[model samples]
Target: MKVLSDAGVNYIRIRLWVDPYNAAGQSYGGGIDDEATVLQIAKDAKKYGMKVLIGLHYSDFWADPATQIIPKQWKGLSDEDLNTEVYLYTKKLVNDFKQAGVTIDMAQLGNEITKGMLGVRMGNGDINVWKNEPYDTKLTNLLKSASQAFRESSKDTQLAVHIETPNMYNYDLIMNSLKTHCMDYDVLASSYYPFWGWGGNNPDNIANIEKMAKDKYGKKFVIAETGWPFTLQNSDGTPNNISYDPGHYQVGPQGQVDEMSAMYKAILSNDNGLGAFYWELAWIPVKAGWDNWQYNKLMGDVAGTGWASITSRGYYPDSKIMYEGKSASGGTSWDNNTLFDDQGHPLQLLMMYKGFLNGYESPANVTSSADIRVTKIFNNDNVNLVNPLKINDQLNVSDFLSDSGQEYLNGITGTKISDASLKAIFNDLQDRKQSKTYTDKDGNKYHYEFWLDGQTTAEKLNNFLKLNSGMKYGETLKVNYTATLVKDKEVPTVTSPVHVTLNKVYGLNNVTIDSPLTVGESMLAEDLANVQKAVNNVLTGAQGTTISGETFKNLQKAIPGVYNATGALEGIKVYTTDTGNHYIYEYWLTTDDIQGANKDVKFGDPINVTYSASLKWVKTA
Candidate 1:
């Protein structure tokens, strides 16, 4: 805290979650910013002699423009009841801080309340139609209620309203509505990120907004939040969100300074520009490693180090459904964007904020403690291709995890990094370079090349692994490579070659399936629940979305004559034998929906499922 205070940072913004615990009392991670947690943070910031600005989320967990889940305690609340809660809750929060001898200089009423705050329950989903209507009126009333309570509780604290993605429309709507309703607020702020910058990173747009805010609304303006990644590298194996930039700034510590400086300069354009708050400068991966998953998870659940905990899953469903993420997730996802490295050692960029006061100057000894650790090891070693690969068979990172796959050790050469998830290796391999050639048993030769920015083979995998694009029948790809890091004084050499190959053990010619009895109470293999499970787990897991299929089951029992291969080759469950060659068969999923007119696809829906009939050879083992 002194590190920031000494560096011209006089204010600290902490998010306040209403009740970040489930009924079981396990924390919901994310700083577990329940009343006690937020109060303590506020008290600590005060000890450091910095003002506190609590971004009251209103919800128990995350609330934003996209999703603002109502707090578990506030569920089933009517609009009027919710208003009362916001007032009472915020008022008590202020009074308690005072009682604890902590002063809150500023309190952001809501965290990015561009959408309906508390929860998104705007009627007819058309609040824009009537800015003076019930939806807007109720929303304003809630803010007014909170504002009244804030003023009543403490005359010392200032009220600030924050929104992200600073633009005119939402800002106009929010500010205009507030003005219309005669609801009081001191500042109208927005998060000015590079990608979501002030009118496309234009500093002039900020000046324009500042002028308008002061002249029209008579309000102070500031950038409530902003951040840029110091490096694109993942420290704890979790992917960083801000990998690309429109400004095309080089990614490193110096780059972070430049990006932040540009935004800060924009804010400083006006005399009353309160300046920008770096979103999360110290969110580093502090003492968590892959070798201790259980320990890390326990700490994450109990200490709020991670984005979420499994114990809090029931309360937070957005993470559960959005892209099928795990409920208990790790963080330091923002470790790259932090002022410190993954090891918790401060980066040279830590001094960047201090530079805003005087003139910008590079740190005298601009060095980093960061290291390139082996994150992902190849997981998909052996796979069966049921269909010839086609154009646009899009690949996913999860498809590459194999039990027997290996990765190059850091600094030296050969060692299997079993600690890394297949996801990690695949994520790292996405941005790469090198080339190779392979010839199959059929004598068909293929050559492939990797590039840093080419769609043919992006990050070593993509459309490049298709039928006409290098991949061939019975060919095992040897993806050999080596790498060295550029020292910001040091990293390691990747000397061991990562050999990756997958065999198309079964193809259409060798494998075929019959429905057994096409009529009567007939059942299709793809229609069986077990077959669907196999397709999702086995086929998609191995080949990604390219080959959509499930096991052609009820085979030996239902179609004994055709689907028989007892002349065993290893642990043979069941296979086919046109020749002595045994093969596994499966029915492919349909591309077209059973009813395309009704375009409703569940987020977790299988890649292949329709009325149309298609078959693919799934796997050998």
Candidate 2:
């Protein structure tokens, strides 16, 4: 908190949960943001000369676009009783904060209440009563009760109704629905992510939404949550919702800076746009697994694991450690998108905020599309003779069928042997009795029966060709490998390249080599080899693993004769094999900060060194 204050951050938004503990007194992992915790955080923020924005989740755990489970204690209350309960809870929470000498600058009525809040637990399970109730009266009454309590407790605190999605249509729907129910709210809050936005994150779209909220509804608008990922990899063993999608947005530190700069401009452009908050700015990597902490215990009781645990209650005798030091199910998927690195160090994005506070010009760049790389493999026999295949070639397929057999043949060989005897041999290797149907995009189905018998299609084909044909072993075959680089049409926004500058304020001694470093012909070569090993280790970890900047720096230092190194690798190129396993085959790293030598290498999983040399000796007087 002090670090952020010193860095020019003036406000901190803290979420308050009604009751985040389970029957066993275990805390849910989201943050035991109970009344006491909220008050404590508020007091701490006040000490740092920062204002507090209180977000009331109104649930024991999380409440979002999906399930909004009613607090367990308030499960069986009648509709009227539930309204009264909400009023009382809000009033008490406000009074508690006031008594603690903490002033609440803003208070959110509900957290992302797009679907609805306080879901009524039907006999079967939790259901959204707000959507089904007559005229949305129940939801209106509940909001009115909570809002009135907030006003009675502290009339000065700004009240906001939070929702998700950056689309203006969704914003209008939420506001109109509230108006129809005769509910009042002072601020309109929404969550925005460029990758998840319906039409992509357009500055114009954000500007229009802010303008519309003020003009049409006479309400202040604020982005409660917005962020971009520095890497596509998830710290936890879960899939990241926001990643580097070609044409949609760039994925890296610079990309985040660009997106954030644009967002700030859009918000500040409108007088009614209060400001935006970068969600989960302080989240950092931690050891995975369950412990006796309140949050961990709650996770154990509720779901029998940590926050990422995907298990049932009473399934395990106790919460078992899943991975690293967190839950086995998954941990923080947004860690990469955080303002800090995995090691809790501030990222380059923090400088963007500093620049904004210092009155620097907002980042300016027109959005452009990224080139999408598409790879399609054809059978060895179906190359130039039939389809005219070539590398770096573009082919428009009005009708395309992606089948196992097609991909398999492409994997083995691409061109058909022109010789009649070779063609006969290939035909003899196929299993003509078995047939399978494949459908094209146009609903046209084609039947295929030819299949080679072996451990793999490639092996079978290779064996047949070698035994019957004059092909030499280990010789390169003219296989039509087609790769297409086309501009992304769906999302046509590309961010500027990232410019990195290492101040060298931190010494290189902090670098820790995890694996053994083999002493090769040179220390630089050994370091490069060690770095490659570490990288491959991470890539083969949980799916979606990404390379970190720290790891990249360590590798550069390993290079002999290099004073400093700073560069970033392009996003990993992923391809799914026949067994449905995704693997990265290629990526490039741009390097600089050499002492006096330039090194070249073929970048891949195990980077191949094509050239190496030591820096020239410099003599000092």
Candidate 3:
């Protein structure tokens, strides 16, 4: 918090989880932002003279558009009970912070409450919980309760209703739904990521959304979370969520800086635009521990020294809260997007932000000029060199002539060359030095300087002719010159690519065999062969075939008995016999690990198959 505050960051947003502890009272491993953690963070932010924005997840774990699971204790409650639970929970949380001398400057009612929060999974099947309620009663009730609770807790703290896809292609459906039902928010916050957000490549649409929210909804517009990755390589061995596409935005530090500048400009363009917050600016990578490979010898082995031992606290049997253990073999996915690198070193973007705050402007446009002079080169021994070569007269130059020299000669001779083509040739010439040479019909050699020696074409031609032969009978030559001045200028547009490695698969859904199998039955040898064949087909499919998280899910769906499939670090472990390493490596892919809001894969990407599993039949009463 102090690091950010010193770096000109004025606001710090902290997410709070409700009852992150399991039934055994063991806390979840991912920061477990309970009351104590929230209080300490708020207090630290206050000490650092930074405003605080507290985000309520209203779940024991991460909450977003796809998953908004209800807290364990709050499940099966009636509408009235749920409303009361929400009100009391929010009110107490805010009041507790107030009593701890940490005044909340802003509060997000719910984190990315796009599909409605407090979702309860019915039985073991997927069902629409919101559809069960009439007129969005449950959603509005929960929002009203949470909002009223915040108001009752503190009158000064501003309230914001957050959504993930306001500027997305489905803006009307989301915003209209919210406006029709719930409209008690002081700030309308939206998440905008250039690589992930809807129409993110187009800044005008985002600005228009900001203006629309302000003008139509009468609410202050703020970009709640936005980030771009410098590298696509995930710290964990899995593929990165965000990838760089040349058609859209550039990648790396300069790309990040430029994107930030453009976003800031767009935000400030609107009248009621408050400001933008960079999401997870301080989430640097830590040493490997539990689920991390640096300290642990194997997955789920917590009884080891170093970072693993420290991370083992959450999974200890005697511990109050027992966190579900994960293999500590991977690293943070957002480390590349953070303000600091893995070594705690500040990145170039940190200083760029400082410069932005200090009112530094981007570089100015550059303008330059060049003189092009053409000299008619002829042989003094030739009788046809009377009036020198006139305009539109073909020079019959050698095929070895430089393109720029040819184009310049073409331009001087009244031959039409499009401005675009001329500019392209000029730009290429300006990029580097070039040389051109020509010989007359009399066997005398004449050299012309297109760019080398910094001499004009006419000067080089004249100097060669004057030094070799001056008005001689058989060697004398008449030189005719035409001075062509060209001017060029540009506003200095720059671009770069941020490369990200991705694990892609193809034909993942083609797993089928001759025999039918039961869901709970053990897999036969033929089934395994079919699975291998399907995977091999994907491996040997079109070279550039790419897959997405949805595709992985569909692959699971295609195989009747197979529960899941994922990319492995070692790739297809069964294809060791193939000397060419043709096997596609993969592991069991989960929704939590795949690209949540980002785009899909590209062509020719090799996939990693880590794990695949078939379901086992269970006897139930």
Candidate 4:
């Protein structure tokens, strides 16, 4: 705290949990950061002459988009009780700080609550996964309750509403809902991680958000949470959340300085931007040994040692189960992203924040994150497009769109947005049987046909696939594509000398093998939304237009599902001994039910088995 304040840091953000105990009343051990823990931290921050911002997770343990477990005391409560608790708890916590002579500068009601907070319903309810009707109203009720409580406690202390920007357009869903509900708050805020590619891999959306918050809502915008890794190596036995991804900078101390400086510069660039908070900068692990790890676990206020504890498994809906095998003590997963090394030394990057004010470093042009949505989403991280597509390779629209946008594309809802995931969603989704095996529902074999630019061809249907799926090569472009299933049972007959009898197969009841297609998202919609949201910044589009940020993000989430036959990750087999041969052999006999290999294949389908009979010949010189 002294170091930071000395370095010109004026404020400190602290995460306040309701309770962090387990069934036996044992500490779950991350930091066991209950109210008392938070109050003490606040007092210390005040002693250091720095303002405090309390981030109420409203959960007993970790509260994020995926999991927002209400305090155990609030469990199985009525809607009224749930809404009332937020007010009572928040007001009491604020009053405790005041009574203790520690004044809070700002209070963030919820953390990374893009979906919904306190979602668990009566007798174990769910948090709102997405912003829809009743849930949105429920979230607003809590926000309204908390906002009132905070203001009642001390209006001088500003309040911030924070959400994680998984999609830049998610702002519309959350912010618009807040507006419609008339919820009052002082600052509009979000969590942005460049490594996570928040808001389409660029701070362009950040500037837009700042502009909108000031212009439309008359609120200042702040990046409440932001951080990047300095190293991929973990000090504790537990693994890190960002172990390998360097993102914009290379790994180590200098990398941390570079990323932090960049983050700072990006926020200050905008007129209404109120600056950013570097998340978990001091969250370091205890030691490298096992006994020490256990000792550290025993010291948690209850489960604050690592990202989460084993005891937190039930409440945290998803991803938390991942810690089942690792240290239940919850060793550090964030040390790589913090300011301290494994041995407890302050890193050189620790002073980067102060350097922005004191001019400790030499002049270097600072460049903010660019709109690299195309490069980040397609360039090997999510979907590898650097390798070219081949004929007969199997792929679904998921190759270029995210799973969240699938329902919209299959004629489910919304206008046709730019997408590469909807078509297969309408049909069947399949895994890569082989790179050469057609991924379209029926395991139909087909090839690449790109409609580069506006050039049309007889193969125009296939031409659209690559281009729409974000396929690009050496500056040339490709979009949209197709591959049809072979309905006929008979193709070229087997040339094998061995004869085998096959039974009769019927056609056409067709249990549409639905595509379990997952993963895809491109930047076309985001590119457009950047312009559209810049004007109105609502779920409802601009002044006269019908499109909103959500509309563009939905488009960014996907395009019409295209038949991708690019054999990039799983290519075709060239030799009989190769493992890929098995998939190719399966593709050789694919038809209308290619997706349903053994289950969908009938008793009497075309039976053809091709093998080789080789006679070795040696020639004498």
lDDT to native, each model = 0.57, 0.56, 0.53, 0.56
**Tens digit per residue, CA lDDT, model 3, 1-621:** 667777777788888888766565645545657779878988888888989898888876667776677887898899889989999999888778877888889888888876677773333223433344463566767887888887777888888888775544445454555577764668877787777644554568778888777777777877788877665544433223464453355666556777777777888788877777887776554542122332122221232211122232332222222234533322344656766655575655666666764465544322121233344322233432224333333332322234443433322122243444333333333211122323444633333222311257455444434433322222212222332221122223221111212222332243332232332333234434444445443333333334444455544444222221332223322322213322333323222322232344433443322223322212222
lDDT of 1: 0.57
After aligning candidate 1 to the native by TM-score, how far in Å is the CA of 524 from where it should be? 39
lDDT by residue (tens digit), candidate 1, 169-262: 6677778888988888899877776655435445666667777788888888878877777777665544566766545455777677777776
Give all candidate RMSDs, comma-separated. Answer: 18.6, 23.8, 18.7, 25.0
Task: Write down the lDDT that model 4 would get.
Answer: 0.56
- Which lDDT tens digits does candidate 4 get at residues 513-567? 1221111211123322332343222223212222323443442223211112211
RMSD of 2: 23.8
Alpha-carbon deviation at 303 in model 4, angstroms: 8.5
**Predicted candidate 2 versus true structure: per-residue lDDT over 1-621, tens digit per residue:** 888887778878888878776566756655557788879888888999999899988887667766466787898899989999999999988898888788899988888876677873333333433455552577778888999998888999998999776767767876877777877679998887776744736677888988988999899988888888887765533334565553455777677887888788888888998887888887654533111132333343454233433332222213332445444433454667888866576766776666764465433322111111123423423222322334344322212212321222221122333344344334433232222343444544343322333446567566555643544222232221132222112322221112122222111142222221221332233333433444453223222223333344544544322211222122122334344444321112223322112222112223222222212112222
| Backbone-clash count (model 1) | 9
Instruction: Choose 2 or 4, whichever is better by TM-score.
Output: 4
After TM-score superposition, the amount by which residue 524's alpha carbon in candidate 4 deviates from its true location, in angstroms, is 69
Best by lDDT: 1
Question: TM-score for all predictions?
Answer: 0.58, 0.53, 0.52, 0.55
Output the worst ten-in-a-row residue range by lDDT, candidate 1.
494-503
Q: Which 10 consecutive positions of candidate 3 have the poorest summed lDDT?
A: 494-503
Q: Which ten residues in a row have the lowest lDDT in candidate 4?
A: 368-377
Q: What is the lDDT of residue 243 in candidate 1?
A: 63
In terms of lDDT, the poorest run of 10 residues in model 2 is 365-374
